[model samples]
Target: MTPRHDENTVFMTEQEAERIRNTVKIRLQRCSELAGHARETRDSKDAIRQATGASLMADMGAADPDSAQTKTQRGTLPVIAVGQPYPPCMLPLRDLQPMKLSNLRMDTHHRGRRLAVKRASPVVTLVARSWTMVFDEEEGGEIERLEVCLHKTRHGQDILESASVFVIKEPYFTLTDQGEATLRIDHPSDLVVCQDETANDILASLNEAKDDVDGVTAAAEKFARACKDHGNAALEKQNLPLAHAKYTEGLKVARQNIVSKSNPDLARDLSRNRAHVNLLLNQLDEAKADAKASLTGRQDQRSRELDSKAYFRAGCAAYNLGAYQEAKAFFEEQRKLTPGNEAASAYLRKIETRLHEQENGAFNFQKIRAGLSRSRPRADAASFVGGTEVRESRLPGRGRGRGLFATRDVAAGEVVLCEKAFCVVWGHEMEALTAMTYDVRDGGIRASPVGLTRSVVQKLLGNPSQVKRVMDLYGDYQGGGNDNVPTKMRPAEEEGPVVVDVFRVHGIVSRNAFGPGGDENGVGSSSSASAGLWVRAAYANHSCVPNAEKEYAGDLLVLRATQPIAAGDEILHAYHDGSSGDYSARRRALMTTWGFECDCALCAAEAADDPAVLKRRKELAEEADAFVGREHWAGAKRVAVARAKRLARDIEGTYDGERYEGLPRLAARTILEWLALAGQRR
Candidate 1:
């Protein structure tokens, strides 16, 4: 009987159909020839099985017989009997390809237990001592019985109850000898709850029920109070980020409550509190905005205290922003709200003195500096990493630009310099929105034609002083005409016709901006690696054998000496991952990316072909690989440590100084880990 075709299926012409039939016939003929040869040669069972499988697949129109063997070898297609039906249990599971849960049989010993669940109905039950989630196929066709062992935690309990449908991503699966499959989720994010339309409907209903004016008001108030309490706790602990986050959350909740007509006074209080936190964070503009927002429609006696605090915060922010007249008005209002307030009175007097001085022809620089110093928080002198004094000098033959030099003796592991980024761009959304070409390696915004233009515009809008500092860095753009900057980015009214500031800033950032440093904890992720401009860090020249290393803590970049640096030694740090590759690769990378030929001590030695250096490195790598392949952890550790020490010694010998110190330390730590593992095995 001829099979019927669906309307959606394209009907083939007689010529096309005939050609396909002829091709199939040819394939079948070839399979028959191979089978004949197999029988004539009296091949082994394995060979015969392969030949038979290929023939069967060709006859069934599954694949070309000639390519079947190749596909089977590569595990792309399974080898099965020609006419036999595929077992239901052995069928490829959708979304769970590569590794299926049903494949985890008790008799087989699998090293890795990483499995992705396609679709599952998680039936959670509270067993004695623990909770277990039995994930079954959605259709309940196969009773494979995959059980996920869950620990007793508030979050875990909540998940077990809430997660009915789940897609367990990269879960560790283990099968016992008795064919009992157990899945373990080490991280909460690994298990994704598949919320279908029904789940969304239920959630929507619940949200609607809670959206009543009274209910919303009460919930928002409670949430705001809790967030404010948490913010206060974070402030006490000196976790500025956490405190800011909590205060922001409280403000959001307070705003929501205000929208529901719950309590305007509570919203005002939250705004006032948030303003205080913003002031502490040195976000003067944000503080002033919040303080103004807090006083927007409030004139009640109950809100008098909040008004006083808001006025003071606004005044302080305005004073820092150099809006003396506005600051004076706010301070006067604050003083009036709280009679006999010494702090408010003192600030008012200072504002008057500053106004009077400004009106006169003479300006007292020392007095202004003292007043500014008193307002700003002082950095701990002992905590300073690099000494405050670093000199920049032209180093010929090194590069076209100047290199930073250490003025004083810098000890190993001492921070040479710590400076906050002038401007930083991060996150996928911002990176995509900003017209910038991003580095594929670290996912940092690169200075593309469009991206740099946008960045310069953003910087100019933020602060012209910051833009000037960025422009001061070494840029490839030589003095050019006004056409370099886009017409849209050009300021409407400028003293000079030259709008090359954008081009200059872009070129400078392209050459000098440090790649996003690791997080505060020195742990890096795709999201954390950002591009930032550090004026001081940019001056330190690049080196394959650098004496110092750059560490990132938030927006701040800290340059630390890896080894003891002499008073007059040039402070250098690697611009790339220098420890991974040999000298040749490092030089090529530097030349290609930064437009410079590296002549660092290590690169120089490598170029001259120092006998037994590259050869020894190759041998050590091979030895480590062989040891690891044989599961000889001790041998692997020893070889790795030796390789690390040899590299460090080579660097020290070439430069006559200790460099690549981290390589040896890392190798030693790895050896300790291997020893610990060996102890566990014993």
Candidate 2:
């Protein structure tokens, strides 16, 4: 049953033995790679042993072997013993759909280590993937309510629908899903099934406002052709904002296409383009998810290339979320995939530098924010970077035109205006509403979203920045010497009201940006609504012609207007899409939505908005097939070097001159080398 080398062949002559030793060295190198990976992952001795055990089980049957050489040969490698499990750098995930993963969002560029108190081992997280409901055969259809690893996949989500419990790193701790994780439903009615129209409305709203929330979010049955056309024309733009608009459309199409898809490949391509849209939109997570999904639905060769991008996206997410270790792993994988990719290398090195700073306790918030603050400064005050009118009322009665929009032309991604944030009360007097109380009946309904709002406010009260902000405002007001204005909010009134600095906020001024951003509004509301709390950021409104965008730099708020503005063009901001799920939903749910009187740019456009435009676009795209074809590149390259004369500041946007200057030279060299090869062939 066993085949073995003869004893005579097992040993060899000295020269032959030398060759054998060289071959053995390669095997040892493989061992080193495996061991090194284990070491790099911060794997415990037990984990390392487990991995090796699994490997040995594959190499030779899972049998006990006393000898070291035999155990290693069979892949049962030994590991350094570890003490107690690394303290759980994990937190309990809230039992909510579209789970909010409890992670420490930090700044790696800051020159200080992120200090955190780790809980004892056995921490748990609710998986984000399991948010999707699963359909069952015997059980009919069911929406699963269970928690798993913080980062489970859709596959995992489906599996969790039926399972009651799960664990991460077995033998440490297990997630008990019996109580709240899995809720049993007696009949199909227990499930929240919606009417066809309601589902359509919800879907439509989500699709339309996916990016720069236009009114396109009203019909779920009909696809939003706006974003689709934008996607098709996205890559054919010289202007970045025009390009951004196209990408934004592509993003909406990609997202809408997902839940209802006939071809996974097309979906994947759309998804890949959507990631680019996310980068443009600054929606990092969605971008990453799209990128990963794209790789899954493509061919192997393309998949590998896309995986490189997926890893790059993961690194970006980890870096943004302050997970240095995870970021490092992702970056390293990217480097391995494309050894000379400048973009990847630049990011990789930056993250490595950040990791060094993090470990050394040098995470500097001001420095990080300062760097984050670095952006193109637009000169115009009448338009946003993409030339949208995104301004609201400025200085109360200075008049609407006195607001954030520009009177001149501005460029892409530029800073427009900056204003310090505060709860300003002129003259330090007048009876300001310190506390406003409202009564609610005991049996009244309290929605989950509202509950979430209340909880978030409670948490914000405990945050240091919020505490400082409140104190600052309190000192500013003086409360007319009434002790009634307590320094610290009562625990019972934690969600009463608070102030914040909003930046580059889209849409209406009442609503707040939440989740990832540091300055989202929560628990702060006033009756009459007075329009609630208006961030100079959110004060802007929707207009067919937007002027400026609200952006933030610490407590400093700025408005960036991109295009030229005449004396009168209703300055407005696009209400953030998905800010309230969708358009009609926003109209029904939100009491007040303002900016345009009614008509917007999208509403008025005739030619571009025409149905013939869609058909013409398809024809034009088809025409391009005949108009364009691939050119050939053969043989070696020897790039030529040259210097160019100085040029005027045309300011259309250039790649720092370095890339432009380098390209022609490189092309010239390559051409010369090819000619030389042709001469040689003669």
Candidate 3:
């Protein structure tokens, strides 16, 4: 059976799929012939008419794949597979002929917003091939070609370079609303660069001197130094991708020359510069490898400064990876090479604190809080790993998904989970950057998802091995596939490359990302609201009467149990501000924001309460608030205390004791606190 273009399952035969492809090719050929004649026609009026007719025929032929015109004609022809994240490990390559740019058409099914692709199974193995081409040029000043928008693309922006050859799998070709043809690649895994030995054929096609603008044919040392200088210049301008690319190009040229191996200084320097760029780009594994490569050359007085910097980069990369011991050793080595290095000394101190947290779970929350208030917060702390585990959430109405659960009995007020955010976009950064996106539902301008989304994608692309950290979390996904995500990280060469669907990342960010500031206790000032995604912490499902409460320390989310929880109990928290006890208001908020109705103990009890009784309770609570405000009046303390007691008692009477299960009454607690203060004053 052949795969269907509009669905995941196969419904057509291989012969039928071929017949449809031939039909499409014949029709497109006719359209091109008509267009060619229109260009050469002698009569001006006839040419214009012919050209318009040819365009209409093309648009009709390529009408969104789901549209009636194309669907009726195509009838489930095998297209490319899309809308799913890539496999965690690589699958064996399949032998399939490549699709060309000429055969591309508008994806009317997705309204040209995404790619239309299909997967075919050869026996039991499913294989996808790619279209190879050299990047010709970028469109205008946008810096994105053959992909969706800058923010939506994998690796963020400005990654594709002119003259670089790469393969694009499951490519989406369409004519934009403005009538320009484009090839859009939605997933980073879909585009693989052809470099090193594999890129030899493509490299041979280009002019050597023109392509080697940095003098690749010159002496190995001279060429390597030129690349280093180019990389350093790009770094200064904050073009990290270009700097890394230049350094990479230089390394390839230098490594091929035996002369460079004899005098490794230039080669080592190139690697060191690339490592620095990789570190800044959050490509931890690459940065670590580059740093190690930089260390192999002579470490005498001449190269002492460079070696020290390499050690420092290695330490930072290791620390980010949570290899505290290795990071400590790197820092210590750096200190030995250059005594009194302040940066290395600071990292050593941080490593000591991280080690304490790793072994004993002891943390200085007070110190972390102090650092969070600075204009530029430092949340470089590592997360604790063993307190809770991700398990299947056993809730009835909720679909098959994972939840965070306590691994052991947790006492009230004890830290249940402390996780550093995977990526955080500070409020100040958003404000200064002036990047804002409006939400039609909220009807207000808010912090754009681009900043936070880009940061997360950069990290994921830089270190694809860690893709599961974000991918494993629940998100706004429909029936794309099963929950059989790989449990263990695998090497790409052994299995296959992990596929990162940018759309999947965007969906996860929307459902799981949190606004970290708006209250006094959070990291930034109240006026500026920051956004972040905490991968592990996000697994906790929402409950109105949450078992755990969240607090912030820098970019870290500290979850503490508000009530004693059993070993296997699922951790839960409120997704919104639950200050208002109005049942209808709470229900509306939860349903609108999270797409779920609250079914927690409190919501269940409140759902059965009498409307009038709840209304009276709200009225009395307001009266008590007014009375508490007049406490500064002369001779009013006694009256205020008496009224507060009556109001608290009245509010208590409104709630059914068995239904509420002795949940704290928000209004009653307020009045009781005021009465206690009044008694203390007396």
Highest-lDDT candidate: 3
Candidate 2 Cα deviation (angstroms), residue 589: 39
Write down the lDDT of every candidate, Cα atoms only.
Answer: 0.48, 0.32, 0.59
Mind giving the per-residue lDDT tens digits that candidate 2 earns over 340-413? 76777787677766655444323343554544421211111111122223444442322333233444444544
Evaluate model 3: give its TM-score: 0.67
Which is the winner by lDDT between candidate 1 and candidate 3? Answer: 3
Cα deviation of 293 in candidate 2 (Å)?
2.2
Q: Please provide, for model 1 over 48-138, each residue's C-alpha lDDT reduced to its tens digit, 9 standing for 90 to 100.
A: 3543454355445553322111111112221111111111111112434344544443323232333434323323332111123342343
Candidate number with greatest TM-score = 3
Clashing pairs in 3: 64-108, 79-118, 80-117, 80-118, 81-117, 81-118, 89-496, 90-495, 90-496
Model 3, span 582-659: residue lDDT tens:
667668766644657877767777778888987887788777667666553234456666777888899889888887
> Which 10-residue window in model 3 sums to the lowest lDDT?
120-129
TM-score of each: 0.38, 0.24, 0.67
Candidate 3 residue runs with Cα over 4 Å from true position: 1-103, 108-147, 150-169, 173-185, 188-222, 236-239, 257-265, 297-306, 335-343, 394-400, 431-450, 478-499, 518-529, 566-569, 611-647, 666-682
| Ranking of all predicted structures according to lDDT, beginning with the best and ending with the worst | 3, 1, 2
